[model samples]
Target: MTPPEAALDTRGTKPPAVLSCPQITTLRHRADFLRAARALRQGTQGMLVQARCRRDNDPTIRVGYTCSKKIGNAVTRNRAKRRLRSVAAEVLTEKARPGWDYVLVGRPGVTVNRDYTDLLGDLNYALRKLHAGQDQ
Candidate 1:
């Protein structure tokens, strides 16, 4: 029965990680997603990866994640996307090429059920094939 402002002390609680990884720029525009879709794409057992060079001289790596309704209802789709984001953070931060945009498309059943390590392997392999000859 205390005042509303005085009753709250949840500052240290673990909230959902919204800006957990700051090094990787997140892609939010539909145009960017479409541009990446028109570019190179590689698929693995866990997910589908689409990548494109922006050619705009920006050293930032931008990425987007998507989950279709085919994955399931809202909860399932979100679960798949969350997994995709987690895997992306682990792999893209090190392996993704700068000045590029990437879109990670979640699979219907594979994304949420696949083992985390295997998901990492899938992303690494897809990236290797996507950026095969461009590396220096």
Candidate 2:
């Protein structure tokens, strides 16, 4: 059977896919996450965002997404992460600042069920607060 993407109609009804997630570097090491955790935190209804300005001048934006077991079982966690990835692809590409590392943590109940537009708004608000030159 043909894949869903390949089975698209000639009428062009299908919307575009998510951004492939390569525009920004990914934060892999535990240290990178720990450091961002120490930097700045902004919480929204859907997710918690941690942002940190990197010391180096690389000008590469880095991002990480995580859903703890508290969020749910493996499948649930994976779903939450997928949604987070999709939202990040939309918001981070433009709103996220260069030379920064950000971690998006999924909340237990809300992350999985929250409306997608609200989720996007949550990330945008968190980013704005972090960059508003607050106490930091």
**Tens digit of per-residue lDDT, candidate 2, span 27-81:** 8999999999899999999999999988787767899998899999999999999
- Assess every candidate by TM-score: 0.82, 0.81
What RMSD does model 2 have?
A: 9.2
| Model 1 score (lDDT) | 0.90
Q: 49-121 in candidate 1: lDDT tens per residue?
A: 9999989877888999999999999999999999999998889988888788999999998899999999999
